[model samples]
Structures are given as C-alpha cells and as structure tokens.
Target chain A: MSERSLIASASQTIGPFYAFALTTNTALGVMAQSGAIGERIELVVHVVDGESQSVADAMVELWQADASGKYQHPEDMQARNPDPAFSGFGRLGTNAEGEAAFTTVKPGRVAGPDGGLQAPHINVIVFARGVLLHLYTRIYFAGDPANKLDSVLAQVPEERRSTLLAYPDRKRRELWRFEIRLCGEGETVFFDW
Target chain B: MHSYKRTLPGTQPNRRHDAYRSTLLRNPRQPLIQIPQTLSELTGPLCGDNPIGESDNDLTCHFAEEPLGQRIHLSGRVLDEDGRPVRNTLVEIWQANAAGRYNHPVDQHPAPLDPNFIGSGRAMTDDEGEYRFVTIRPGSYPWGNHYNAWRPAHIHFSLFGPSLLTRLITQMYFPGDPLFDFDPIMQSIPDEDARRRLISRFDLETTVPERALGFKWDIVLRGSGATPFEDAGK
Candidate 1:
C-alpha cells in the first residue's frame, strides 16, 4: 500500500458540554453487581488541575481484569477463564466536586509484556476540557506485595510512583482513594502507551 | 526512520492564543514517553451488542419534536491508519443549538435555546465503518477565550477506537465557515492540511431529498500509521 497523505485529525478538548453529550445511566461506573464473585470494592477518584483545583467536568474510565485474572476482551488469548458476572470495564464523569467513584472488585494479577506477573492494577483514562489528549495512568493498590516487582511500576521514578498508589480510606474500609493531579507538584504518573 | 508529529507547539493556553482560553494551569510542556503497549491499552471497552438504536442517531427527535433550523445529515467513517473499517465502535456527538446556545446549564448565551433540541446523539459504526446523524447546523457562539471571540459553528465528536490508546476526541467544522481563519483553536494546529481534515465536505450522495443536506467526514485512528519509535537525541 502507498503511504497515506491524509493526516489524522488533531484532537480537541472534551469541553464543558461533554456531560450533555456522553452521559448515560450505565456510565456511572458499576462494573460488577451483587451476584458477581469477588470482594466488592469502591474506587474514589478526584480529578485536579495544576493549581490543585477540581476539574468538575472531567471523565474517568477504568479497565481491568476480572477477579480471577482474566480480561473480558477478545485480545486476551490466554487459556484462563473469565468471570461471567464481571464485565471488567467502567466509566463515569466527574461530579460537581470533581470526583468520580467506581464500584468493582479488585482485579487479580495479569501477565506483563515481559513475561512477568504484573501487579494487580486498574488502568485509568482521563478526559477533560483543558486536556487536549486523554491522560493514561494506572491505579495500584498501595499495600500490594507485588508492586515492587511489577515491570511497569519499576520503570517509574521512585518518588513519583507513590502518586499511582491508591490508599485504603481511613473512614471507609471498602473504599480506596486515588487523586489524579493533571499537572504541577505530586502529579500522577501518566503513561504514553 | 519515520518521523511523525507527536505534539504541536504554539498551542499552550498562556501563549496568547486567542481562540482557546488562557490559563496558567495548562500543561506547558509534555515529554514524549516511550512505553510498550499493555493489554489494558490494547483493549477498549465494549459498547455492547447494539450500542445504537434507529432513533439514537437522530438528534432532532430527542425531545419529542424536531429541532429548529436547517437540518443536516452528517455521515462519516471510522477507519484505522491502514484505511480498514473499524466496525461497532461507538460514535458520539454534541453541539450548540441553532441559535448559538447550548442546552447545558453553564451556557449563559443570550440566544434562546430550542426546546426541542437537547443537542446530543450517539451511533455505532456499521460493517463498513460508516455512521450517520441527523441534526441541525449549530450556530457560532461567543466565548470568553479572548476579546470578541466567537467559536465557529462546529460539533464535538468522541470515538472509542479498537484500543484504549486509540481513543480520540475532536471537533468537526463546516466547510467555508468564516471564523475558521480567525479561530485560534483551529489555528492552534501547525499543519494546514491537518487543520483542513477537521472540516467536513458537502456530500450530495448522502443528502436526503426534501429533507436534510449531507456532509461527509472520516476519522483515522493511530494504528493506520507505522509503529512509532523515539528518535535519538532531542
């Protein structure tokens, strides 16, 4: 095939009216229900800008493997079985306070690209008005033993890695808290891939 | 070595770019990080067996009535960099009303909003990667981005490609919009040809007789390009 001359369209900001266009009942971020087999957990996220201000109009999406380490995607060619009850995906727009919460089970370890076992993590994508391109990151359980050995986490600078860890909430035992700062100090570790 | 444009410069909000809002908080510089694609990035969220229904593609009937203004039939295809159709992908659109006012709460434009138009719709691409929407042409609206700056008539589009990394959000503009040259947001892109890609062409073939006119636009995801690699040195 010949080299294509048409350049791909440049991206624009999600803008303020994205909620009016994209919101749906299912986008409220409930990946697994009561019948799903796993320890149910809630992920609470706050989207912030460089000045530590809340980004109320941002959209957050979560993708992860099922509790049994199986992804409900066609690309997962492994012989592992998936949890029928788990859809393994969720999306939600930030509220007036720049916060979004997801109800799902903690995912199990998945295979890393380097033939190693990656630590359990939830992949996150952020879209908002000020951001021209969507930001990509991961949420790792703060106390997970495998974090130190995870290939992806190992590549991050030691000091900045903590930004990717989601700590257990002090008041709520079932909830994990993650703060994604789009820029400035304590910015979350964003990925390019 | 293949050199692809990563990020365009002269687009920072603080760069006195009049078309977009100026703010101190925008990311001034972005480092191009090289990381291998993971399963999570390689896989995208599924839109279910039938992401769109017959009526979902029509923005004119959302509020139980036809929206006021000139109706149009906007059609497009979602293709990979290889030019193959990307079927079943979800396509979403939103825009201002015919009077340059959005139905959103934050919009304070003096123009009256059309009660019949909520200004949003969704559709899944067909086997040929084609999708269509029926909606009225949006009007130019004033924004506080700069002095006397009015956004050109345009529609916002969001698409979920085959992989999460390929997800894209862009705006589609009408051909021959007078504000195209003055709009800082449109001029933010450095390449002239790339900027032109954002404008849809008038398509008589897809136009409905005695109904809405047709406009054609196509979106190409990143996979259509050769594998991206980091160049040595700054």
Candidate 2:
C-alpha cells in the first residue's frame, strides 16, 4: 500500500440526547420492506453491561444481503437480481429495557473474501454514549446449517462462538433472541478494525 | 486495493475511561479480536435517492422566521486518509439550539428552545467531496456527567463513507472553545494534535460580509491504500 499523509480523525461519543437530531423523520429501523422475498423474522437484541445492568443508550446498526444472497451495494458486483423492497440496512436504539428489535427478513449466504460461500449472517456495529469507538460484530442464526462452513466464524474461539449465535424463541414462530454482554463473563465477541 | 490501514493504538479514546462515568458499565473489557476485512467491511449501504431535502443543509430557514443566534456557515470536505476526496457520501449533523437546549424530551436543561430551529440537518457530498451547512452557532450546555459539567459548543456529525469501515460519528468544535480542557469527551483523545482536528478553522475567504461567519473543518475517514503486488514477482 502507498504511504499516506493524513490519519483518520478520532471518534467521539454520540451523547445521550442525540435522539431528536439523529433519528428525526427517517426510516427508524425497518430492515426488510413488504414484498421482499425471504423468511420474515423479528430479531430482538438485548444489551447488558458488566454488572448485568441494561444499557439503554446503545444503538445497533446492521447490514446484510437479501434473500437471494446478494447485497444491493455497488461494491457487490455480482450477477444477481436486486430486491427492491429489501434495503439490507437496519438501525435502532435500545429502549429502557435495553431491547432493540428489528422487523427484518432472514439474510442469505454471501461470498467470502476468497470467493468461497459464507454462512447466512448479519454484520453488526454498535454505538453508544460510552462506546468511544463503535464496536463491530456479527449475528448468525442458531439453526443455520452453513454456520460450520463460515470462514469468519471459524476464526472465533469455540467457546466464544456462542456469543454470535441468536437462538430462536420457543413461543414466537419467527422471533430470534440475542443478547450482547458488553463485558465480564459471557461478553459478546467484538471485532477489531 | 480497497484495504484500510490499521488503527494506531492510543489515538482513539479508551472505551473504559473513568472520567466519563457512563463508560464504567458500558465499555467492553475484553480485547477486540482482529479479523480479515470481508465484503461487509469493503462496502456500505448506499443511502440512495438522496434523502436530503433542498434546504436540509440550512437549519436556519426551516420555519417561518429565522432563528435567533449568530449565523455561521459550516463547510468542509470529506476526505480519506490520503486526503483523497470521498464523493457522494451522506453527512448528518445535529446540535442544540442557540439557547443550549435540545429539542428533545430527554434534555432537561433549563433553556429556551427555538420553535424555528430543529437543530438537525443532512446533506450529501458533491464530486469534490465537500459539504456546506448554514446554521446558527449552538450554545454550550450543562450535563449531569459530573458537577457543573458544561459541554463546549459543538455539533454532532455522522457520516457513512463508501465503505462500512469508514463509518464515523464525532463532534465538530468551534475554534478556541473554552471548554476544550474541561470537557472529558474532548480530553478523551490522548493526542493533543489529534484532538485539535475536531475544531474548525475560521476561514476569511468563505466569510460573507453581513450574512454569516465561515468555519471549515475537513473530516478524514479510513481510506483504501494502494495494494502492493508481491505474488507476481514470487
């Protein structure tokens, strides 16, 4: 790589009172729109702290491919049909109970860096008042058969792999439950830049 | 060719800084695991159709009357690490009104909120990677972070560069703000020079005679470095 002169500027917190300015009259947190083809699922994410206390200020942003295993981004120069209804972008802040739920359809398999197929997954980034720099992670379905074949998931430790899995709820036919522990025991795995 | 540079350690604020009390419980203790940048990192959502409005960049004229405050023009370019222009990116900004009061239910600060000012704006960068906003200077506000914690006058900035790795959320400060030394959020950056990057410079060239003062702060985001070809020689 060529040597660069400017270094990227440091990041600052979003602060507590960013709700009014940041999320005013925009698509708050709708991931998959109507007419999008895929298994419609409601994903609920809970955020907790080292003391097991709920963190109410955290905001989660997720990006994934459509049901046809294709991203609608320009960088995904693949030969596949684009789902006009699916935006593949989901954003929502946690409530007082530290829950951020999304009405999104299940993402399909995507390509890895080396051109191999990857497991169905969602790329997640978390931002909060306390999170100085945003944290990166991924969410994978619990019963996905392709999990074993994911190269990225293989890099994570076996014990810590559970931190990335979102288990299906027994009562809700299309509900999946995932919790992110910021620190201490059972802390969710965070990826570095 | 689309790979990014590794972050220099200590340049960023610690997630567990003790001064910011909110970080005590919210910060993750474990070290972040390093991984290869996949397609997810290489690409980001293209906020297509330009959701920004014709006057979205100007926060002063949103209502029937002009807001009460010192008018200013905030302008800058979105550049990559190599100072290359990052074109067609989305830039979103939010701030307190001129009275240091946010138009939000959560802000309990005792200040008047201007009915004409919502304190929120969004704009898309041009081919030159530049963005301009016309708004009043936001006032300093007190916070419950600590005893008599008054935040410096600043505007919150959110940007989505071409790549997901380039996503950023930061605050842009006015030049020579008195709160720079006292604010934990400003002091959180370990490097003094890096912290100065957050402050905008007063530019005389962009200043209009009687209309608005001008300030410029070019933001730099993570960029793709030129990939060296080694496999060909081997």
Candidate 3:
C-alpha cells in the first residue's frame, strides 16, 4: 500500500435510471404481509421538490419500533421484545405520482433515555439524485398528545414542527397522508440525527 | 482526540453549466440544510440472518441458461475509513446487460436486452469483509443527460455498514472507459483523486483463464476521513 492510495469510490447521484439498476420486488416493500399485529395503517408519503413538483425517482425507507414499542435492532438496550411478524423496517420508491405507500401497524410509544415516554413516530430516510446525500426525519401522527411530550420533537423549532405530522384522510379510515418537501417554504423538518 | 478531514468537497459549480436536464446543479431552489451526524445517524441498520443459496452472489445464473455476454469475476472487500475490514455487511450490485440495455420497463434504449440477464445480485461480507460476484460485463448506453451523451460501462453498488450513518451507495466503473471524459455524473465529484477511486483494476490472479476476466474494487465506508459533523455550524 502506498500513500494517497485510492479510497473507496465516490458516490454519484441515484439518477433517474436508478429504477433500472436498483428496483426489486422486495426492495420496494419489506413487510411480508398485512395481517401482522396491532392497528393496521396505510401511510402515503408524497415527496416533492421546492417547486411542489413530484420527485418520482426518490427512494424512501422507513424504520420504526414494533407494536410493543420494542426495536428489532441490536442497539436497543431495553429488554422489551419485538413482534415476531414485524420486521420494523421497509423501503419504497416514489412512483410517478410522487407517492410511496406502506401498509404497517401504528408503532407504540417507546421509553426515552430519561425514563420519559417518547412519541410514537416512524423514522424516514430519503435518497434521490439531487439530494447528494440522504435526508433524515420522522413522521408523527397528527393530533397525538404524545407529540407535546416527546423530547425529540421539543428540539425542533415550534413553527416547523407541524411539518412532521401526518393527518388522517377524511374518506379513508386508516389512511394517513404526509407530504415531504425537500426544499423551499414548508420544507419538512429534517433532523441531523 | 482524532482529527478528520473534509475529504469530499461540496457540489461542483461547473456542473450547472451542463445541458443535462436532471442535473441537480440546475435546481435553483435546492435546500441548504447542513447535516450533523448524531448517534442515530452514525448507527446503520443491522441485517438479519437471511438464508442464502449458492446462486445468490452470481448474477449470471438466475436464468435457466447462462447470460449472453462476456463473463467477469468481480471481487471486493468492505473497509472502514481506518482501513479495517467491515464484516457481516451486505453488498448488492445491479447493472445493465451486455447490450447496454436494462431489464427494466422504462429503459427504451435501442440496444437489445438479454433475456437471460436480470442484472441484480447480492452477497454478504465474510469475516474478512470480502464479497465476490460473477456476472456479465455491462455495456455503455445512451442517455438524455446531454447531447449525444452515453454512460460508460458501470455497476451500481449499495453497502450497509455497521450503522445507518455509514450506508454507502455508489457506482463502480471500469478502468479506461472512453466515456469517462464526457460523463457529467462522473465529473460531479470535485476531486480528481476521488474520481479515480471509482475505477476498478484488472486482477490477473482473480481472473479465470479462458472463462472470464477479473476486476477488484474495494469500498471504504465513512470513518476518519468523513467531514466532521460539528463543522456544519460554521
């Protein structure tokens, strides 16, 4: 090995042709079935640019705790257990309508570091061509009282906190809609973490 | 205390002048958020013990018959910024067929698609962070990125590190691709050395005589050279 040896390859944007290279039946959605456990919910995520135009090429991934508020990850120090049927992780690519839909159960409240209860929320990671790097954020159910007590939500600016909430659809009982704006006014409150 | 360099530079300014329609450089209202790595960002998703068959790592064997193209042996190791092996991680790759056409629906390129090639494969790193895949050599294809622009032969790679923050998605290019000089996507990386890092080298030892040529490419995940997240405030 010599000095100034090549490091790993530099990343290029996941251009429009990403569908050509990356799309797979399992990569688009991870949940094995809809009959897992807890309250079944349908999450509709619309990714848009600053101009309010849909971003069809973006990839959206979701991570959440199981119905019992336990994560499937090894880092979860708590002794709580994960629901055997729930993988607690999923990935979906935005379609021409800029929507990435996931059929999952509502996650339960998890215990925060300070022994306080954190709000029920789903973590999201967005990757697109122009994004250069992926963006991190969370989706909290709108009108949930837990949002007022969540330590993570408290770190976000009061005015922009609403951007993280998703409202239930009027016609569809279990459907919720959340719009993520990558730039411009009303951009979703992206967290550093 | 360890000091890390901001090795990767920001987006290039010259790219905005390119005629590519999908270029991010032309996005006048892009967000300017400065990302700071936190504990959640630093940790990557842990993979479960999904069962793998012998053919999982071989892209050319999916179809009933062999894929129609020149066979290639691709091997690589996953390393952290400190140059230590990153074991138990997943390495995935996808690419076009030998005709420079994809097995996807949206690819309308005039090139013919090989029915025997689905063009996707995955392999988990061993204890030493090594992964190998046997696949056909992909060809170059034209894109609307610019006038008469064609992409060079390449393979897309996705890696999941120990933590979420280290997840890397990049493309591996062949050495001496003629289109390298004209590809705006490849030129987006500001550093000359970083661009060279994308090219895989010919490894005679790994080559199968009279069967396939071999190429070796190692992927380095974020670590010492990563931009210090704290500097985003300045």
Q: Clashing residue pairs in candidate 3, if any?
A: B43-B163, B43-B164, B44-B163, B44-B164
- lDDT of all the models against the reference? 0.79, 0.86, 0.74
lDDT of 2 by residue, B1-234 (tens): 367887566667878888888887777787888888887778777664556789989999978899999999999999988787888888989999899999888888989989899898899999999999999999999998899999999999999898778889999999989899999898888888889999999999889898999999999998676533532432
TM for candidate 1 is 0.90
Q: Is candidate 1 or candidate 3 better by TM-score?
A: 1
How many Å off is the CA of A115 in candidate 3? 7.2
Give the local distance difference test score of model 2. 0.86
Give lDDT tens digits, candidate 3, residues B1-234. Answer: 122223344422222324445544223343333343332333336663655567879998876899888899999898876676888887878888999998877789998978788888888999888999999999999987667999889998888776665666778899989999888777767678777878899999999988999999988876543333543533
How many residue-pair clashes does candidate 3 contain? 4
TM-score of each: 0.90, 0.95, 0.84
For residue B220, model 2's alpha carbon misses the true position, in angstroms, by 0.5
Off by over 4 Å in 1: A1-6, B1-19, B22-24, B28-32, B48-51, B224-234
Model 2 alpha-carbon drift over 4 Å, by segment: B227-234
Supply the TM-score for candidate 3: 0.84
Prediction 2 TM-score vs. true? 0.95
lDDT of 1 at B69: 91
DockQ of each: 0.42, 0.76, 0.30
Sort every candidate by TM-score, greatest first: 2, 1, 3
